[model samples]
Target: MLDLQWFFLLLVHQLIQFSSFSMGMRYLRRRTKILLMGRFLYLFLLVIMMSFSTSGQSKSAIANFQKAKEAFKQNDTDKGWVHLEKAIKKGGNTYYQPLIFAGDRRFKEGDILQAIEYYDRALQIQELSSIHLKKSIVYKYAGEFDLAIDSYQLYMKNARMSKERFRASELALENLKFTKRKYEEYMALGAPLEVVKLVFSDEKMEYFPSPTGDDRKLLFTARMVQDGAPTDENLFVAERSGAGWESRSKPVLGRVNTRLNEGASSISADGEYMVFTACNRPDGVGSCDLYYSYFDPVKGWGFPELLPGNINTKRWESQPTLGPDGTTLYFVRGSHSQADDLDIMVAYKDDEGIWSRVEKLPSEVNSSGRERSPFIHFDGTTLYFVSERSPSIGGSDFFMARRLSDSTWSEPENLGFPLNSFGDEFSLVVNAAGTHGYLSSNRGKDIVPEQDAMAEMDLYEFALPEKMKPEQRLFKDFVVVHSATRIPLGLANVKLKGLDEKEVYTGTSSKNTGLVRAMHDGSTALRVSAYKKGYLPYSAIVSKVELADNSTLYELPLTPLKSADSFVLRNLLFDTDKSELLAASEQELRLLKKLLLDNPSLNATIIGHTDNQGGRSYNQKLSEDRATAVLQWLIDSGIESGRLKAQGEGMDKPVATNDTEEGRALNRRTEVRLR
Candidate 1:
């Protein structure tokens, strides 16, 4: 017969073995029979010992239950739980409070499976069916959808439920059914889906991963814990390396990250600017406000600045994502009174660089339920967000909407199941190429042993489903710089023009990084032009065939427009000996006209050059005719003739040796000199 001490030691050994099984050691399944035998022997010995200790009357089960409550109050959870289990075995169906209390405690502690077992034991002992509803909720969270639905239906049929409980059960049933259907559909489609946990994820909750357009850097939020209690959520960064992501992440934006919570951040496509949400800060205008910070190579991150009143209202505003244009921001705004009714709102920077009044998305995008975590793809047309609106699997599910017009959005479409499970899914961001997507989820195999399996959220990346993906377009990333110093030029105006010379798109390089990006539909040939103050303008043509390169990185060098600064006009063409410009030269002439118009106080001299083949006098006249033709075109195009002059070098000054064909071709050129 086992003594009490031996029984306790055996119980500890059994618990150790069970912990290995809980930790997902499949080989431990063979030890299950051994554990069951040990438990049986423990109960047998306890019964024998109890019989010996009691002479005529046994301890009242209610008394044992009271003792268990006292033990729990004193913080002895193990002893309390063991005593409560004994009371249930002794009292059987005579009492229900002990069983219910144990179940509630387990559920509160996040032991959903153990809570369900306790609830099931209570149901078997008595006809109290109301506990089924509690079991159903626990089952649902544990991903046991089929069992949850059955339990919910049983509770509704066998017990009197409150109106609120009835409504919740109805909603849950509908969601479960929808989730089942979606899972079936996903299986039918056979789409190739893969989800990978980021290497840097840890036991603590890590979520809201925002990667730069290059995918070389990642920023996320981690819930920091101290003394086993959550303290604050702070932004963390991980840089990609050849061996994978860095082994660990560190807090960034020193001054920007205060003791207060700072998370749900969005980095600009160029990785130069960041916008994040902070709550209850001394400078905040609302309960939660969006803040902005910019990166500088020399100074690091600037101090976080509260957004303008137009974007940050006295109400709550958070989760800001900048459009690829870097001027439009989409964020979540909640009413001061009804905090749960979050709506996705957008604001655009005006010509003065001030954000406009926040506008809630249309009803088609924002439903009566909450909508949050708006991520606009780099393509600029597709919008992905999280919503609790019906047709969702259960909780908040991922949905996408496309821009139909400037102010209109298409009906939101569900991202479909597996991508969006019964669990809440949010903070999804797609890469520039739109092929890969990242989000925070708690539905996969656990990587951190200390974390609850599939309960603590971690960042995950998956192949973007084809049905939900946006139209793939070629993107061009531009880095504009000064020619002499190689320093990035701020406020450089960049424009994309179609073959017909219609301006398709326009944006400015970042003030700090001098980077800009533009996307094309892959159908048209495009010409890109960049211009900065007091610098010569630059333009390049990308043919449709070159769009297959996926991305084209261009470093545009702009020379300062100082006195006597000259450059060859590569866009101009003429008949062999005639001075009339070709149609291809029309675009360049228009650009020059704009330049002259923009700088009215400035003047330019148009000079033409010729190769050595022609006679000196004849070549000089030919050059003169070319220069005169260009001046006339500029004048006709609205440039004041007084601001421009014409001259001919006529082989007198050659930039390249004129002996070879290539050098001769270069020598025969038109030049522009600012004076």
Candidate 2:
């Protein structure tokens, strides 16, 4: 230190002595210029001498710095740190280089306190604007949030007005605030989260669970290794036991698991079918495409076939999630060239039992960043998925939205805090009862002790927070049958319309089983209908209380299309105490129009009946007017006016006792009689 100081003092001394030579020759201009050149030469000599003295003092620092570099190259981080500290102590404090390097190394190693100390020491030596960002990050890691925020403010303030560093400084501060808000909000609402590790699935790293509507089983993705070869992703199943899953010896599910990759499956709510992803198959239209398989009564699961329609392209499609009723499917859709631009897509099954063309969800849910692992809850309204968009918890995080209508969805809400962290959390699903949620994460070691310490990805179930829960759901099953013969009918198109919101769900009864299942919220009243070829359409308005019994099976009994056959139109709606048809009757009216179009030679009489609430004469006229409305609609829909006749029963014949509201609702009906 003294030698360096002596070097600087010597330079000042030579400068002063050379100025005297220049002053004495000032009277003669040429002599003065010569003396000035001599004075410059003397100053250069002094600078060269100082350089030698400083270099001699810095030799030990340079040697230690080289040692630190070699240690770091060899990956001996601890040894590198030791050498770095020694170098700084040996007069290496001439610049902020070594100090900042040490700070970054410690920060990357997760040594928060040491990183903070090094950054603080470096900032004192030279107040570099970039050092403030390093300091801010270390403070954030230490949970000193207030200090971290202050550091970010200083960093941004010291940054240049127009430069690359300023943008990073600005974004860093914004992200810090967003992360703090998300974390604090989670803490404020957070409770005791009990995450259950499904060790039953721990054998080969099972993930992306898709629970059946009854929560009776969990279908997940795993690996299938060939003879001494690399593994291919495949589907597996785990049956639900008393309170947990049954640890099976080998639960490889179905013929879907082939030598090629097939994974990320979704089971229908009725457990009658599944949709999964397969890649590079002979028939595939993309790198990965969604495949469909049906449940067989004799065999466990039938062979998988490529999903019908334009659902696949040159892009990749994976991670399918079927809606509870099995009518709609949601999945991940990504481009072959841009992986980060993945979006969540959907498709609906039509009356013909083929999936419609795939449509990506709107930008409201699919942000500019990647969207993945969509899981539609059994409630049939809420959708949970993963997004790497803004306000994320570093990596990907779980976000949820609800179906506002068939075409629109609500704003996405982050599942928040302990449920999401610094790493990726994906493929989140809620149980049938909405009591628990399941997901896949590599955070098993930190979240639970019993889980394997090095578990890369493990299945876990956590009780869903109250705000995070979807609506309580129940399974609604039914069969379409003949009214007189009581014989089951297949290929019936059944639709359930929620009375509260007019939200409709559609499904086709199985061709062989004659079984139909739809998800119900257990609260909203429903207008359920069934239609089939060569049969009269059947519809009934079911009250909310009737929808409570999950085990109850309802029936849609259709009368065969023949001369003189009549069936009740229970879903027909009219204005109170009037005959004008309400807008609510449009759906039922469309079905009647289709019926007339299908049978051109058929002639029918539209008869309106009333409950036992009004006078006979008044009821007769009102009923007659209501019946005429249907006839007029048929005529307007291109049915010949002479082919339809209107009549009124006027409460003369009661179908039920009418003592209770249910029986009265049954008695009030508009019926179509084939003539």
Which candidate leads the pack in TM-score? 2
lDDT of 2 by residue, 494-564 (tens): 77887664544676676556677777766678988888879888888877777776576788788778778
- RMSD values for the candidates in order, in angstroms, are 15.4, 6.4
| Model 1 per-residue lDDT tens digits across residues 1-675 | 336656665775777576546554465675666567766766776666656544222366677788899999899998998888887777665466778888877876778878888887788767676798788777766667788789878887887779998887687678777776776688788754777878878766787788887777888888865675777888999888884778788887556787898898998767777899998898888888999887876776779898764998788888888776555789999976325689999988754357876688899999988998898877778999989888777467889999988789999988877678656675788887778888887654521122342246788878887787886756666778998898989778776666765444465777787887665567778776777767888877666776556465567788887766776676677888889998877757766776777778879999999999878998899899999999999988778889889999888988899879979878888898887
Model 2 Cα displacement at 46 (Å)?
15
lDDT for model 2, please. 0.77
